[model samples]
Target: MSEKIRSQFGCSKMMLPEHCSMLREQALAEYRAENNRFPETDEQLREEQQYILDEARAGGKTVIIKTLNSNGCNHYMGIPLRCDSTGNKIIIRTETGPDLSISAAEVVSLTIAD
Candidate 1:
């Protein structure tokens, strides 16, 4: 037995203006949240940041590196293969792809994965 009143409204061709506006606002909010909209600091806090990275690399522990990029905040989880201060980058061995070399300038935070 099918109920005629229970029509599927998924992906309707038409949408109200209010609905469109609401969706636009929601998308903008999500973009800001994902990008870490906080003001960027001029100081990189290199010494403190490097200390955390060194600890993780020396212990051979998996770490989560949160980086801020033009697209947004990207998260990389893996064991660090190398930390090159002179080159201003760190290479990480991820399970799904080739080792990633992330610039120190883009790094927002680094934490050991539990």
Candidate 2:
């Protein structure tokens, strides 16, 4: 059977994974709301996220983010941030400083990393 046919048959037999489906839907919704297009893959999501991050950084905005490191002692001086493609979430480096670190659940409020 063709790959498309196999996917269709297999999809009917199992539920879509929640994370994948949610990311797909979010991508579609954002596309529709902005450019009336749909993201076809996770790579597209990464591209979008990078674009936004670059734009913000270029504009010299101070971004808020959730730290991936659970321990708050790691140095983030030279590492780049990571972002979720479909969601408005970014990972930042947190060190022993007075800067505020958000939780992953509160990532929507991130602005730009300073």
Candidate 3:
């Protein structure tokens, strides 16, 4: 029922709810690959983020934080360095290059793996 409504909307730019809904699926796949399980709730996602932040502060962990691309799509990989004061930006160490600073609004998910 709801699945039909969701797939019907897809990622059309005009349908914000559909975009938001699909983001969950993206986050789920990332979470599963990183943790070997799917998050059961919003709290689980938050806990995962906190765990990544703590691990990042501790250093030497591979972290993948999803930030929206220029086209407003999400999928990225990097090491979390830290977030700036406004909470709207973060610095990340990229897989093949230098650090990158991206907007907090652009970040849709977090995945930390060994």
Candidate 4:
């Protein structure tokens, strides 16, 4: 007589636990690389980003800022308040939350909010 197939465990092929976890990690890394691109690397790009920030500050326009850090990238939208003399840090007044203070070095990109 032929052996019966198990109901709980399907008859399909199985992968090792370690291999499955490794594949998951690889997929996550690829996604992060594509989505979380490194901010401006060259001097010219950095200057352009700074220009956008300055314009937003001057015109009192709401700006969307993307910052990158060790943890990950963060997105903030608000009106610029002020920056230190050296422009090392920036302050933004948010609508729903308390003022957010961000480090200039972490800023990746900026855009005027609609």
Best by lDDT: 4
Which is better, 2 or 4, measured by TM-score? 4
Tens digit per residue, CA lDDT, model 3, 8-82: 655344757789789998998887566543234366666667677678757867777665544545565777788
Q: How well is each residue in 53-108 modelled by candidate 2, as lDDT tens digits? A: 57655564544433333233222231225555456444444444443333333322
The top-ranked prediction according to TM-score is 4
Error of 2 at 66 (Å): 4.0
For model 1, how does the per-residue alpha-carbon lDDT over 1-114 read when each residue is reduced to its tens digit? Answer: 334345455434488999989999999999878666644544456676677778888998888988887777789999898988799889999878899999878887888899
What is the Cα-based TM-score of model 3?
0.49
Q: Which wins on lDDT, candidate 1 or candidate 3?
A: 1
Estimated TM-score for each candidate: 0.60, 0.26, 0.49, 0.63
Considering summed lDDT, which 10 consecutive residues are worst modelled in model 3?
Answer: 32-41
Instruction: Give the distance in Å from residue 91's predicted Cα in candidate 1 to where it truly belongs.
Output: 0.6
Candidates 1 and 2, the one with greater lDDT: 1
107 Cα displacement, candidate 2 (Å):
9.7
Q: Which candidate model has the greater lDDT, 2 or 4?
A: 4
